[model samples]
Target: MNGEGKVVCVTGGSGYIASWIVKLLLLRGYAVKATVRDPNDQKKTDHLLALDGAKERLQLFKANLLEEGSFEHAIDGCEAVFHTASPVKPFAADPQAELIELAVKGTMNVLETCTKVPSVKRVILTSSIATVFCPKPPLGPNDLIDETVFSDPSVCEENKQWYLLSKTLAEDAARQFAKANKIDLVVINPGFVVGPILQPALNFSVDVIVDFINGKNTFNQRNHRFVDVRDVALAHVKTLETPSASGRYIIVGPATVTTNEIEKVLREFYPDLRIADESEEGTSPLNYKASVAEKVKSLGIELTPAETSLRDTVLSLKEKCLL
Candidate 1:
């Protein structure tokens, strides 16, 4: 797992978490083949190139998750593959089918390509905490979820259900395939990923942060596990090197807080900024039940607190002029 001369292909190089993965890989001295939907887009690649060490080690390649053999070229000679490219849209027109297709097919495509190449040793999948817990209330006060717990797709129906279903099916597909093919797979199930936005664009998760900062919602009772994107990226890197880091790891922060709590922190830090009141009517974007401290810590990961993580996120957004 020496990254000095290793080649790593990061799917969805322009994405929020994937970009961080690519940056960390480059920093670790790995020659990166970043797969984008379109490598010709200068705007996207420009920001990546601006990062230190990216100029020499980074290589952008155009590959679609849906297309067969699309990732084959990008993955050639790669020793490790970070599959962080999965649909995050909460409300897709066909959430189940579309998510399933991308998650299962895309993973299969990556693994198939790995089989074609001799260098690939491991694949780190960016799964979500949603894959480990459901939106509904757990049975007991101590009903904390772990890597063993999986989101039940049968319970998923529409709208929000689609995203969860997709994650569940996709992760399940990966596990099944890994067992069958004996592919070295390490799954990192992170909670609501909150961190400084790498790109100027607002990604799917950032909509919640934007809504809170823009005074869009008013209720504050909901709570869920949250984690810093930087920490999650670090976990991916650690899992890559840790040969024993097989199976699933729940990458969550030290604490869970509601949107209202986050808003209060933002208002306190930036008094001039207008913030939203806690909302009571709308559905929560979080799954507050999942708690996998024992499991994640087993991998030697100490999560940052939610307050610290959210504060950093807000500061980052403000610095980037997004606030």
Candidate 2:
């Protein structure tokens, strides 16, 4: 086992993508120290403790992302850290305090703790595609946005897109901190993640599907890049395992999909359900394509087809009686 004697810490242990990462890490034979808000909460910890290798290899630690030194106890002896916890709420009464500050401060606290821990090696930050090419830039018809391109923070703030702003600032803060402290940092920027839900409740991304099916969505009608939650998890592990992987990597499905396209697919899978056909006037349609370059492809990831991902997501929702 590649992870036979290795130890890793995963923040946000019970989250949709984080849970899958923990599962894969445990399967690889790594002793996992997973951090959550409440370790005693059965609803959150049970699913994690029930994973195949979890009984012996998994440990749940209580930590708050915003509190300094909260992560040290869990990260103390770990060789690798996967920081996946971030505020998913797009709108809040105080977006600056609740979203941006929390994300950046929490990320700094985790990195600060990592610096204190001698055993820590690499830190994998779960960033979103929103950080890249968001608030859509003016582009030529043939343009393709990649890692080098970043979302304009000023533009995001002007538009009140606080979630995107938070991710952008947080990732920037992480990069600067990692460089100054000399910590090996690898970032995984995944697009709209969809697939099975390991956690008992639905996450923001999966809820997008639910909202669509229930005709309750107010999300903008625009093209979006989609990726399976499992693929996102695998990318995190692969980035950690592959020593050569450094800097930022975009993780997304092969093609971009629109709201109508997604609804079309869902209608096929769940013909009985009344899915929404309309969307509020939102961001304009993308003029340029957004995709992953060869750098991520070099990791040898065979992406799951978008249809398969959508079908599997709904099936999982049904299994959980969420649909």
Candidate 3:
């Protein structure tokens, strides 16, 4: 189907990734129904409202992820839906109430809405690599981790990986519901999403870079997977446009790098900043590999380089005065 005048809904449109999805959808000339927790929050919605084609093509609807039927109206008459709302906070006063319950319940709510809304043909869900992460794969021999691997629920429980557990369960629930109802569902499992931000608030992923710049001692020291935010947004667009796109696409960059390598690159570009050295204590080594070459290559999408992604992310944060 042509995307030109078709209607699509993007839940959590005010978020870091959803905002870019909304922007790209609008640029493609789609009538976008953007659902935010509070449509009246100008600070959050203003950037979306200011997009080039948003004046008439983009519509904001107030919707809550936890509310069962909240997404029905927003999704009505839309051909596709982008579910990007999920809690990703590192710590919560109540992990279950704040993160686990919300992620699972909110996903169920969206799935229920899709069932009720008949016009919806495809649902593109934004799931994290957490769902695919197996901190300790069973005596793994393979060098590259793909979409087949999954996080160990028991390990998550034991290690207090509440965030990973929440995303894993939510995605599992979404997939099960979609399959039972015979709905077309596509999931994008992204690693650390980093790049420019179109929203007013800073993205949590950016904090990893910010922490490194601000002399924070504790952060990911080993090689970690990352994908550009813009690449992630385009992956959503591709999934919507390409009917053959199905199942899960591990949307990570082809390369992985350590935090130290990133800091070195940043230091070369911005030497005046207080970027901390790797000599800081409490840094641990990580050994993991992820493969997205076949999947992303098949989709005809190219990812941004690690250095480019890091540089643009930091510059954008500085421009927004959030650095």
The per-model lDDT (C-alpha) reads: 0.77, 0.86, 0.82
Q: List the residue pairs that clash in candidate 3.
A: none
Report the C-alpha lDDT of model 1 over 1-323, residue by residue, as the tens digit. Answer: 35788888999888999988888888888899989988888867777877767888898899988898999889998888999988887776775467778877887788778778888899899988777666444434456666777776766654357777778888888888888887899998987788777876778676677777776643343564578888888889888878788889888765667655776787877676655454443444443444565666765777777777777777777787876
TM-score of each: 0.90, 0.94, 0.93
Question: What's the C-alpha lDDT at position 261 in model 2?
Answer: 73
User: Which portions of model 2 show Cα errors greater than 4 Å?
Assistant: 135-141, 279-281
Candidate 2: tens digits of C-alpha lDDT, residues 40-59 = 99999999999999999999
Cα error of candidate 3 at position 282, Å? 8.8
Q: How well is each residue in 37-146 modelled by candidate 3, as lDDT tens digits? A: 88888999999999989998999999887787988889999999999998888677898999999899998898888888889999999998777765555324345667
Q: Which scores better on TM-score, 1 or 3?
A: 3
Models sorted by lDDT, best on top: 2, 3, 1
Residue 122 accuracy (lDDT) in model 2 = 95
